[model samples]
Target: MFVIITYDVGEKRVNKVCKKLREYLTWTQNSVFEGEITKSLLMKCLNEIDQIIDEDEDSIYIYEVANPKNIKKQVFGQEKNFDELFL
Candidate 1:
């Protein structure tokens, strides 16, 4: 599974959030976090993440990979590639 977390958190607080997530996730490129997360664990982490940044402006995106078979096709679609294009 993958998660794209966007935040306007101050540098210090953002680093804290990243550290917390690092305990459970492997740091992927470009602020994308990845891990083999269970539904319960993922939810828990997300909640925790939100709580940590509750006072800050942040957006957390959680995307589950359901079909490895069609990943390329799915990702290449216009809708999905929109955000990725800036990278």
Candidate 2:
């Protein structure tokens, strides 16, 4: 499965979340991650994130795409080279 994970987290904890997520996903943009992950692993990732974020002040959104080929991504500004990692 393809997953897109984004978060709005408190400054002090943001880096910690990002670091943990990097273990399972590719950092596609600031506070945003995308990659293929098993459903079980996705749940594990969410659980880990839950432990790091403050519920009242932080939010995380996860978008799942069962088929990556069906999705379209378009970039308007300068894009960093994450294709190698993503592909």
Q: Which has the greatest lDDT? A: 2
On TM-score, the candidate that comes out on top is: 2
Q: Which 10 consecutive residues of model 1 have the lowest summed lDDT?
A: 74-83
Q: What's each prediction's clash count?
A: 0, 0
Per-residue lDDT of 1-87 in model 1, one digit per residue for the tens?
544444455565677777667666665544556656667777887778776775645656666775534455323433332234445
**Cα lDDT listed for each candidate:** 0.59, 0.90
Q: What lDDT score is found at residue 15 in candidate 2?
A: 84
Q: Give candidate 2's TM-score.
A: 0.89
| Superposed Cα deviation of residue 67, candidate 1 (Å) | 3.0
TM-score of predicted structure 1: 0.61
Over the stretch 35-83, how does candidate 2's per-residue lDDT look in tens digits? 9999999999999999999999999999999899999999889775453
Regions more than 4 Å wrong, model 1: 1-8, 72-87
Report the error of model 1 at residue 83, Å: 25
